[model samples]
Target chain A: MLSETQEERKMAEGEEVKNKQVLFRNYIDGFPKESDMYISTENTIRLKLPQGSNGVLVKNLVLSCDPFMRLLMQKNDDSGLFGCYTPDSPITGYGVAKILDSGNPKFQKGDLVWGMTGFEEYSIITETESLYKIEHTDVPLSYYTGILGMPGITACAGFYEVSTPKKGETVFVSAASGAVGQLVGQLAKLMGCYVVGSAGSKEKVDLLKNKFGFDDAFNYKEEHDLTAALKRYFPEGIDIYFENVGGKMLDAAILNMRIHGRIAVCGLISQYNLAEPEGVKNLMPLIYKRITMKGFSAFDYLAHYSKFYDILLPLIREGKIVYIEDVAEGLEKTPAALVGLFSGRNIGKQVVVVSRE
Target chain B: MLSETQEERKMAEGEEVKNKQVLFRNYIDGFPKESDMYISTENTIRLKLPQGSNGVLVKNLVLSCDPFMRLLMQKNDDSGLFGCYTPDSPITGYGVAKILDSGNPKFQKGDLVWGMTGFEEYSIITETESLYKIEHTDVPLSYYTGILGMPGITACAGFYEVSTPKKGETVFVSAASGAVGQLVGQLAKLMGCYVVGSAGSKEKVDLLKNKFGFDDAFNYKEEHDLTAALKRYFPEGIDIYFENVGGKMLDAAILNMRIHGRIAVCGLISQYNLAEPEGVKNLMPLIYKRITMKGFSAFDYLAHYSKFYDILLPLIREGKIVYIEDVAEGLEKTPAALVGLFSGRNIGKQVVVVSRE
Candidate 1:
């Protein structure tokens, strides 16, 4: 299979091939647009790793479009967590790839792996520490970009570890049709919780109630008063809140929170594209209701990936859980797919298919 | 002593006597003013418990002027935690009292106690569940209002349990000279943490540094930019933040918090007077830093009062802990003293001395 691709390009073992990539133009201020990045076919990469360089040369197959990528597009000053994207360079993110050649003993040629990689056809991943070998071929390889990957671990950790959910509790999740929210709502239902969700469109709301099995769902865009909308759904008050969208959604959730409720803040998608994020004013409820609002990420719980896999894999195989993805066909659609996240353009998890192999 | 007081007023054990009280005129909107409550001497009460009623009649001594009392002045709709003040009624609060007559076996005549009572010369405490007998009198009686009462338990629970402080970590306390903040700062220092505090005035700052044994102190009022001011103090970032004053101070502290930092939301005195509390704008750091912000109260930890008393009592007896009180003489001054809290008028723990007896 490796020789066939090399022969198609008319290249030898150590020969160079044209590497098409999407390069970030510069640091952006507000919402990202397709113009912020440019597609380039001017770069070339050797199929083999250089001698004494312990790196894996991989052929990029699938790329993920996540909300956190927007933060990387900004010039970070003090937040040392994310490595900001450099201008005129291929943007790096979580992706699935096939190793073509390797100087590292951990990965061999033709091995499939998923983790951090460049958004290019073929490249050398110097920091192979972030990559994990794919052993389960029974699942779709693109599942590594959503359910079996970052978003999967995020839902497990946020619901179980951060939210501290219990059976029969009332729960509310915002951005119900998104990658993490969909999984969380389903997981809450499995725990026997009375779950309600809010999304942007009617289609997403239908998917949440009928597809994800949320007890009830609402279209937040149609509701002028979010606090009233939440109160209408949760007449008794919410016991746990899976906070995906910040701004007014967060403020309203606080008001409707039960005594000693927990809010697992996984993302603030509503504020990511704004020049200045909206301020949350109803925090006084935290004191009055004795609420706990904690912030966490999948990276923080990566060590428990095996535990997450054990819990979710069975549910997936038994038909107890389902996943949805909106896959863009080619790498050229990467920029638009990523930008679409801010405008609620995608129906579910957004992924860009770079190559089938 | 009870007989002497009854004889001085020319009243028998079952006779009526003039009861001067400060009555709440109406529910307030913003900051409470002295005019919001009026001193009335027309009320009279029988100096004895009612037949078949398990209640205690007591003479009020020292009353606590706490920030939470401001919250009760508002019209409460859903916050069932606090019982709101009724129009044309004696304002209720924490106070030290001497029992004159008792219908319950738990409390006897001439026993000194501290708990919830009316802000008047005399009060019939129907709920004996909230009161605790004063067994140890070696410390000043006024200490019960500041260091040995609700505020004392608040500091102990917030610092040790909620914040989860580790030795040699960094701690920042806002409103450092107040009842709870003062004790929290000292407790953090005793645990070997590098402690810094922010207060409203230079005098309070001096007390925090020199008297309360805080490692560093600053006057937050003098600084135009609170975020820069916090960064100057906590260059390495803060591990634990004892949040007493909310609004801009909370925003500044969020920006300066270390990874996995804990914020104990004890009070929000700064926002008590505002019609609309300020919205915190820098909460994104909670996600980047993976911070935990929890809200708690002394009432939640009342079951652990023995544990708190065991720890704080020894520190007070050995002079390892020092308490400062801004005692306003006479019951008529209760309204003025409480109103002073919003303006940063009183230093240390504000207390009203109803009677020295």
Candidate 2:
């Protein structure tokens, strides 16, 4: 999957004696700039877990590029709810890794797993509870950082669990070309629901319609009036809205919502960079329409992991569910790729490949 | 009970020949004014239902004063969602009435029923499906306009159904002295929740604490920083918010919400009269806290009316639930009573007492 990388970048030249990390330099106010963080080429990593600790020492192969990571780059009161990243340290996020040494009986050295780790070549995960052991490795290993990981389950839970899919219902997804959005569209299609998505570009819109099997998709950047655009796609009104980009898009979605509609608030990418997020004035329609707007994180649905894998693995194996990753080659490119998310540069799941093996 | 009115005001001078009605003068632009409607003292009324029609003719006794009536008075696009009042015609709302004649088997002469009907002395109700026959009369007959009718069911459904109560959740209510708010507080207290309320004035705030048994109360008008005030009271965070008055209160509540908190959005009383409603800028908390904000109407909760009465009627009879009504003297004062809702003039459930009988 990471074909452009050289074998030298994949090798740890000095083993555990030297490490590389993407460190958080300072707190960000608006959109995170690449300069707000930096590439630290020389660091030390302990080869083993400390005594009496259940933590796993891992060699991270791939790092996930998620929009929520932007929220972590800020200075906030009590770290602002989602737990802000500490400045002067490597940022932590979902990544695919191989266990270097495990203090817990459940994992072993060389075990491949995916969960929350650091944006570095090697990470010492203090909390190994959320990590899942990767199996059925017929697909690319980097998929564990994306479609087979948080974003996959997030789309599944958000669509099936939160939206409570009803056959023939009209669904509108914002940020439709993103990691979660692409999968959600396919899942809705599988459930017999009419699915439409809004993306930021024509290429992404085309991918949504052609590759992801979305009923239709429009480039939100091209539409000046989203309310009228939604009306054009959903003349009968939207029954379920998978809200990924909050603000004016959310306001417009609320206006186009039908009675008893459900809005699953997954991610608010549009508001992540704003100093003061946009005011939503169209909420009165929520009462008239009796809409239910629910905000949730995928961590809450991890209990359904086995069931999710049951549904997803077969789809991936049968080519029923397809994933497209925008791979950024090398650890050096990770900072720019993460920054690219805020600017909508990635066409699919933005993943940084640290190694191929 | 029509105690302030002279006996002449209660009498239908010419029986069926003279009917008193409140006619909508015209569509209001912002906030319904007393000039938007007027009382017509001399108008003919039908004494009986037309042949083969399933209509019931009833002599109205009490009319409900609800904030939603303000939306009905405005000239909106098809009244926005809820049906609008027709200009130059008698306005319609919930009322208590005694049947004078009936063509439907579900009702007979002298049957006391309360439901949506003309805001007039006598009304021929064609659709009698939603009307509830008076089952218990130990309480005040005018209670039908407030506690025993729509507001009672609304509060019960909002608290127990929409908010989904637990034994010890922290509860907050905006407009806590009003019809729905008063009962939601009592119900939460009864369910073993620590409930706090926010009202517009000192008197209403006092009523919330002293009369309604709220754990604490505040005058939102006096509090410059609602978020800080909420933080002081709910040092931990709010678990349930019965949203009656939206805008800044809702914004503050979102900031002070605990993980998995629920907000039952019943009405936005503050935004009802505003030409441009204030935007809720802090919905991101909904994601971090995993909050659920459901916007609903009492009309949707009518199926729970029997269960609501089962919970409330005994509370009223046993003196466990107390009610406060700001009763207008007669039908002549109905227009002023209705307009007073926007200014928070009436103390509790604003009711128009048409007759003692």
Candidate 3:
């Protein structure tokens, strides 16, 4: 072992600062609660990267609270869609991080990147492939956690690639005011398609119609008969259904879908929390209408990020596209912010800020 | 009115020969039976074609017994996948017919064709576009009702167009010995795929493995745990699933589907007779696995018949593909043959031989 110099000794001591983290407890049963995860200050950080490693040490700035995280909390994971979080470990998801030290040639010290990371002050990302370097910063850096992140690409892929929408087509989005749905509704509007959105609250519904520019919007909670509500909104039948919430809503959407309709499955927020998810009884419509239902992940479409930005960046700069985010102030509020997602408390994309700089 | 000449009277008397017909009594309940349809020799036919008509008078030779016919017996008919049989009128489906007279330019008298027609001895086909002219007479005319007709094209479209299979890929076909399933298994084998099939009986299973050249075959009815059966066959997970039998089998198929798997929804024979269809519970895997479930109709792909024939005809001539037909002699047995499909009684592509001439 080489002897440490005086400057190295100072650097080593500075690295011993406390690293606060939100640690996931044992696997959840029914709905996840804030108590399912607790804030932990026991773990400390070593800021320097180990030599000859392909890992990069990042200081996490903003963390996203997504519904898919609930799916990861399940004890028995058969889907194996997103990997599960380990017990007594910091929960990982999409976040904006600043590179502290790098061993990989693709990244450098202090580069702003938004991708996958743990919900902690600092994370060692051995898999540099998950991280995409942030280029344009004129928009808020926290936007990387929501609109410019997974939700953005998800909506784009679903609307353009999966739905295969033609101009003047009718588009319906479930969970219309959520991070992905909001963007999907907007994308449909830009394509000159008649767009309708369904949300949980009146406020969210209003946001969908007014802010997101949906042709019409409704609060799904107020409607006693979902199929009737869908029929009333889409009298001609839905051509493209962006399925974010599954179960009865999905059945209703299938019933109202026109011949040769398309359904893009991005997330199932409603079913993720249930011990036993509801069975879709009206799938016979799939055959009758010749509908195509496809499920896709954003990571698969990341290769076309430059193409996505070519369309999205111009929309953002000109205010043609709008994004709504419900942000929690501090890292300590991460658990509550995430737990609130199930109860429909968050108005839009939920994000937790660890640090401003 | 013009006076009837002796020659015109003789021609009209000749056309008055017994027009044997199967008339639908009413919309069905539970299951369809022979009593639901009664043979009527009462309806008379007109021998001379109407002037300025785009119709063709056909002598129905053979009729197809399909599972989709059962769905047409439903009372509500909300799906509208197939048109319902009108009360006191004959049910229409794919059949082999001899054109005795034609007013359409595309069809001529004595032109042997196979297409959609009524379940009667003599019928007028005003919609001649649905008909396909038979080119090859080397094959039996009865083959038009099975191997060369709707079922053949259905299997082709489902396997090639929908499954989008690659050579050496794994394919699992449910209802393996049925009309479409048998052809799908053979097509998969011809593509050099690892083909596995599931049937209801040991006899059908033997046919699938021994005769159809499937890599492996299992009786789904014998297996208590379908997911376990699938896991045993495809340890790595299934790449493509030709979904013929929906319900429990579809649920299991979804559970065993690999990343980016495709499911071609051809028929849901299991759910057709049930008043309330079974609910699919494992749809959550769709989002995680990123699976694509596409439901298509063979009629929509009729334009590609020559393309299907380009591949299918060569296979038939080379003895690379073989088709099995279960013929129920006489039009009197048509009702029993169609109902037999629901109970898994028919051995292969069920056909009702109306007239050998």
Candidate 4:
């Protein structure tokens, strides 16, 4: 057994020398076109940790293709608030990885970890704080990239802390099957609130209603009048609106919001690619209804990660919560998988598989 | 004095027979064209309190002409949440009044109060609990109609409590010379914040800077690029936005907000009149910036009313905070005064004086 383990380590080191990488050729202009990225493999990945460093070397397993990554690739003046990603650099994103070697004591050899990993098969992480150790091997490791990772915490913190949902209150969620929205809908239902969600495709809409236990779901793309559709689904008007698609949907949601309603703004995927965003026409409803619309990032709620894990892990074990992953194989498919998110092609949480464990 | 008191009581009884009042002609379709209402002096007002009711009879001294009243005039199929004023009925609003008679223990005969009163000389109030006694007599009685009134508490609660200011942060106020905006700007200044204000007119802009002590003031009507103007004023980006004017101003403010910014939605004056209110075009900024925008009514914060008085009265006495009022002479001018709020015709708070002390 000892001889076999030594041989397996040597074979893994040999494979690490050959780096299979997906590179972002240039920064996206308006909407990310399919032709922007070309996948290519590189040789000579450094297996040993770099000398005099706080960095850890890891083999990437799963990578998340999120809407926020598109914002990072856009060429613009660094709005000075949040730092923008520079061109020609390897696209860095949240991923599940296995640590091959570590110079820091916080992590060790052969440890399974998940965090800000690269799109390539191997990455050199300078900030060890970014990576979180994977505990509990009972569930699928890929779950860390979507359901148990950023999206889960986002829905938990925004809905519970910001919206402060009351039992039997009406909730409206946009992009209902996408990562954050799916969890938000399910969480609202769990909290004893009536949930309604909107998606672009029929499959996603059906998934919301049947699979996720949402009270109602609508295909916003096919609906002629969004406000009427929202009013229909939420007869009493929405008490909480988990906003994912901004623009016209936001305007319509404003009209349908109940008095003293709370709108937890998660993401606005609709206007990400446009040179100029669409306007929200019914903002006065906010005044008459006395609504509270707040926008927050998942990073701000890291303090609640342990708390989120405590609640969600049990739900997952009991099969009370379901997360659908739109998985694409290989690093070469990463770009297309990511681009599909903007066009609403992905029916669920978009994820890319680098290798099968 | 005793003979005069009896004569005044007898006159009050005689005046009850002649109901001089303001009534909505019909539900308004768009921006209130002046012909929407007619003020008529009638015979016989409702003098007696309803049987088995905790109601009061009030002789209104000052009636506020707020922009929100215009929203009540527009016919919405829904109960219009918050109970819209029925068509062809007396327009009810916040005002300062003298209690002519009372069946509630909190109020007594000849006591002064400020509350939700009708747009008329005398009214029979059923929900007398919503009304509160005017404790401080040092300030002008008309102050209850504007500065020391709903708008005052609005600025205090929204800015101080909701925003929770930090020193040296950039604060922006919209409709800066209006009742709420004026106080918001001053309060921001007192918190050691860098404040900028946007008003409709050059005179109002001047008042914001010269009178209200805003660090900078701009006429949003004159500036073609509101987003650019916000970027210029809030170079570091706006940390707090007191949102009184919505539509384009809201869009611009959203775009210019700093990460973790707070926006207090006091009013949406811009969208109140439009058939379909102008949409906010750049709402996507909320997610990136992680802003908290909330809408609140002073009525909800009644628990803090006495504390509000303790804090604000001393500020007024020391001349640390100043107030502005635009008073109309008679109840007959109430319709035009309320309508004037939308057009920016009133300089500060628009109030109609029905009687003098």
Candidate 5:
């Protein structure tokens, strides 16, 4: 569709050169092994910009490594809970990028943006609406992927909007080690509620208590009886349950709920990979306790994005909020970095840097 | 605490009259046997009415035998579902009664009323606010206990208010033969939705198909594979699931629910008596399909009571809506009528008559 002069003409125009992409090796299965994905350079990048297009070209600097990314690596047959990810494609995620060339009206050359871009060195973005220009770059740019990005909004909405937290109420959050859960636990603490968190490892449990300022923390993996453990932690019974893991954990929380308790279901990480999820037996408690349980997606709450940033950015500046990032260097490590989520290899928020200044 | 009226009362007052009473023999469990209850005159009513008190004394003519009454009869420290019925008290239920005497300003002598009275000939009504005076007597008087009363409101609120039905959508109703189910199935039909119902007997299945105009009907007791049976009936998947029975039936319904399905939980009859209810294995289906399963109490929706009556009364008058009544005569038959629900003995709406007009 373009003339032969387009490639040569663009290079002469003083635009930055194109960059290579890291491609997904193949689709994966349950509990993805590190070998399921590998670095490949089969996909090539065109150096010259095409003429008369409204798209923007950007060099990706940082990529987000999330637990949901592993789910995107699985072969999709349309039978799994939520659709599966396809194989032999450039695996895309939330990333921060620097603009090389732009034909769009809003964005210009040398602009920095962050959004759902490619997990590569550079990308030709067809839709510019998804990208946001980096306005507050005083903080580390990588924070945009983990703390200021999807996970940040997720925790904020789940706690404030869905949970409808009240001061002095007891709050329980599951999977307290990961990006969203850690923020939710801290947010609950800030709201003046007695907060307790359940993580998979003792180290995560310690981090939740010491670093996140949670009132109490328990390693669910070490607990023999989850119900008893909850009773021990919350002897008065839980008023709000921020559910990140569904299955027996939900069942245990149901038993320990007080009258008029509320459950805000965010994600079900425990049963994500199972062929069949476990049964929840203690639902009868809902009738007796008169519990109100609701589920919500962060995408549905986009109206509150600006309000969330207005409140969160100032807290970050004042050091009232603390965020941790596990950054892996180079685009080649993106696959293993994503797979590390299921294995709990990352310390706080898992992220990968494709290129840095 | 009467003043000295011994000589004066003997000369002016007539001899005290004793009113007939129906007493429960004792509490019973499981499909209650006939011997569990008997009409015994343990006490006599005071025929001489109290003067100058803002209370009405009524003679109950008809009594509503609800399945919840059976739950009250079970001897337990926790009658968590329904409050416990005292051992020797006159069993109270929703009933149509004639006012024998009244000191209340609203209700006068000879006024016919239907409300929560007693399962006896004479009941001293302290508060008359709860009673709805019977005005339109053109229909069968027993209809107040079934079609025009509690069950009617239950069906209307569960289907319209909770399900939030869209025209031409596929709807599935469980316990399709009982008081609430028959009305819900008919309402769905009137709304132009494809409705399927599940009953306990083949006769009920025929009634749902022919009398109630359900698009399809199945006898759940006869069906071996509930999931397969549902799939066969609703190949396109269910949009609205009116959950009347819980445990295994609820689990089966969850598996067959379509994307963005709504489950209006009305009653869980199956799990009420069980020491331990069955665990639902496919609860994760709710997360995947973005289903909304809300358990609501009918009392919470009292604002819609008049709205329900305005729409439903006209349908009954036009013969477009049909209601069934299974009348069990005499105060002695009260316990058996309630017990009949558990074994699916009484078809349609089960009621008992304590007195003739």
Candidate 6:
């Protein structure tokens, strides 16, 4: 997979190439549709960096479609930490890339890296600090966008750092079949916990129970009373809740939490597309239960990436951990792949293959 | 204040007394009304404990009228941590009492104590473990129902322990003129933090600024846009929010929290009377800001009561800490005093003087 053509090897450093890119059309209000983004081939990039530049230029391999990306599509207040996507420009997200050229000494040509990159064939990332050189590639490169990248680190920080699970404790994860939830459930199981998950579809529910090794799984769409459904599964009550789908699910989880329960707020994918987010009504239970609910982002835990990598890499090598991905081929399919997240369309970690090389 | 009449001292241990009681007529649904409770003198209680019973018989002194008692007035599921008030029975709550007779070795006759007791002239408390022998009489005995008891410890734990406040940080407290919020604001100020509080009335707002020494205060009822109001007061953002009133206040506080802000959930006086608690809409800010929202009760911090007492006793005696209380006279005024909390009718810690000695 690392082999380069003789033409690419002989190509001059200053050579130019056509770049196929996915561009954000405009700020979206409701659920993002495929038309909110468009594929463009009019842009081009040089194979060399500008003089005195400290950026890294790379060819994107696999791009990740995450729920947080939807938040970037909306018109955000400047007060928030994240910046919104610029219209008519290439949308940026986490991806695995092969360095085509570099002005920074830390990265060299052909170095495999995974971090923030454009949803295009080529990107000149000015923030070199955002990129991390991929240390081990013995496993599938696509895993860098799922199990070995942002989603993987998210599960590690959320489960081990935030949730603080103890042995034999009961755990519940919302949006359990998604990239982060799947990993959290597996991590809880590895810690000898009774893990239960809730998803929107029967296929994802089956995957959670059979493939992810969750002790129990339920289809939230099929449950009319979420509180009652959770009570049935966790008769004793939930000890840790990995919150992904907020709104009513969060309300229901609050009611079923045990004393001193911890809720790790990862993402609220359920409320991202709504004009107004649904209200959480059961917070009163938090007082009597002595619960702690914390919200965190993956960027905060990147400093400890090595520690997480050391723990997870071995599990993957020994077949103790399993990762599932729904890959969409070609940059042209990026729009549909990204839009599918809001509707729970893609089955596992949604990824768009921009380039096989 | 500890003196008893000669007749009381000579009375036989098994003598019965005319117990004037405030009985909970029935399970209530909404804001508890004065009519929901009735003054009853039909019941008589024996001063002596049953044979082999390790209970203490006490004559009530000062009774606490708290917001939590409203929760007990409603029919509750047995799953919750606290028990509900039984129909046609004297409602139970925190109070200061003088032990008339004791079968438990932990308590002695004529000893002053404060703990859970019936809302009557006399009560036989079987759970002697709940009682704490009053150690100091230098402060007003009525202080046991407010600054020296539950509300004081609540403020100590929420501010110093849960909020993890730092000097120069900003603090916001809702229901600021009330028992818990008033102490929380003062505690933050004592730690060299800037403090702001919100209450329902202009009088409370004035008391917050002038009497409690809060940096600023607001009348929430006058603020049409709570988020905008909070933003105006805390342009830099709130670091610690001692949450007393939930619903819109919580929603507004969430929007104004700084990065890594902490919210200590002490009480939700605003939502206690509602048939359905209001939904909190701004919880999404918690993620981007990496905020921690925790719910805690004073009972959890009781083990450290002696440590807290050592710190607070001097503050009260030296005039460094001032406590304001709304004292209602007579046992018959108990129902009206308890019912006034929901309407913001009480100015400070609501206490009923059941007996002076």
Q: Name the candidate that leads on DockQ.
A: 6
lDDT of 6 by residue, A142-254 (tens): 99999999999999999999999999999999999999999999999999999999999999999999999999999999999999999999999999999999999999999
Residue-level lDDT of model 2, residues B82-141, one tens digit each, is 888898899989999988778889998788999898988778898898788987888888
Per-residue lDDT for A273 in model 5? 74
Better of 3 and 5 by TM-score: 3
lDDT (Cα, tens digit) per residue for candidate 1, span A1-357: 234556335435577778899999999999999999999999987767787889998889999999999999999988937769999999989999998788899998889999999998887899988888988888889888888899989999999999999999999999888989999999999999999999999999999999989999999999999999999999999999999989989999999999999999989989988889899998888888999999998888876687898988889889899999999988889999999999999998999999888
Scoring each candidate complex against the real one, what DockQ results? 0.75, 0.67, 0.66, 0.58, 0.27, 0.77
| Better candidate by lDDT, 4 or 5 | 4
Candidate 5 C-alpha lDDT tens digits along A73-113: 76543232445444555777788888877889888877888
| DockQ-derived CAPRI band for the predicted complex in model 1 | medium
Query: Residues B1-357, candidate 5, lDDT per residue (tens digit)?
Result: 112244125224633334445455576655556566556565555533576778787878889987666556667552133465666677677888878677787887778888778777678888576777877788778887877777888889889987899999999999998999999999999999999999998999999999999999999998888998998998888999998888888889988888778888777788766766677777656655656676665555544566887888899999999998888877777767877887888889998887666
Whichever of 2 and 5 has more lDDT, that candidate is 2
lDDT of 4 at A190: 94
Error of 3 at A115 (Å): 1.4
lDDT of 6 at A315: 94
> Tens digits of per-residue lDDT for model 6 on B253-277?
9999999999999888889989999
Off by over 4 Å in 2: A1-16, A50-53, A78-81, B1-16, B78-81
**Predictions in order: lDDT:** 0.90, 0.87, 0.87, 0.82, 0.77, 0.90
Sort by DockQ, best first.
6, 1, 2, 3, 4, 5
In model 6, chain B matches the true chain B with a TM-score of 0.97
> Model 4: runs farther than 4 Å from truth?
A1-16, A29-31, A78-89, B1-19, B33-35, B42-54, B79-90, B103-105
TM-score of each: 0.97, 0.95, 0.96, 0.91, 0.81, 0.98
Docking quality band of candidate 3, CAPRI definitions: medium
Cα lDDT for residue A152, model 6? Answer: 97
Q: Of 1 and 5, which scores higher on DockQ?
A: 1
**Model 1 reaches what TM-score against the true structure?**
0.97
What's the i-RMS of each model?
A: 1.0, 1.9, 1.4, 2.1, 3.2, 1.2
Deviation in Å, model 3, residue A132 alpha carbon: 1.2
